[model samples]
Target: MKYSLLILTLLLTFSMANAQKIYSVDYENQADVKVFVVDYANQADLKVFKVKYQNQAGKNNGKWFFTKYANQAEKKIFFVKYQNQADLKIFFVDYKNQAGWQKNFKKSLLY
Candidate 1:
């Protein structure tokens, strides 16, 4: 039981560390991930939830906090003009309950 618990904890820690890093780029060409903000959740590939604290940021689960500077961010994202031009498309949900990735294939774009 102790070994299982240890493995679970390690998995959680590794996943968290692999996630929780995001940056916004000034230009789309410079970004490692190109994203688009959809007007509605139904139109989005991912539903995002912006958290108040940086530590709260998680995987494709959408707990994000926009940092004041790019240097403080973990993953740099560029906003694309069109959804077709984006590597991942997202929508900001009003509530945390609405957050998650619709297309799991694009989930790696954030990490």
Candidate 2:
């Protein structure tokens, strides 16, 4: 039973590690989510934390790791010229603990 539990835990962790990889696109029209980088954390609908490892990234809690290729990304994001045109507005928080969705309604955009 202990070995079975360990196997299950490892499988879950491995699957999660490959999830939530993001790609930034040059054009807003090509994006799954049109995003705006807010100047202040208070101005954001989400507070993002850029994780160094892909295993550390998660859904809607603002943990992101950018991938170099679009094919490798689970989410493709484009930066909008205006905040009003954005589907999601985010601020890059300095601390990992500060990362999360400020607006619950916008959570679906990331997931």
In Å, residue 39's CA in model 2 sits off its true spot by: 1.1
What TM-score, to 2 decimals, does candidate 1 have? 0.75
TM-score of each: 0.75, 0.83
lDDT of 1 by residue, 1-111 (tens): 999999999987775574566778898766788888988788888898888776577765887877778876777889888888887888998888888988788777765
Give the least accurate 10-residue stretch of model 1, judged by summed lDDT: 13-22
Which candidate's lDDT is highest? 2
For every candidate, C-alpha RMSD to the true structure in Å: 5.1, 3.4
> Cα deviation of 81 in candidate 2 (Å)?
1.7
TM-score winner among the candidates? 2
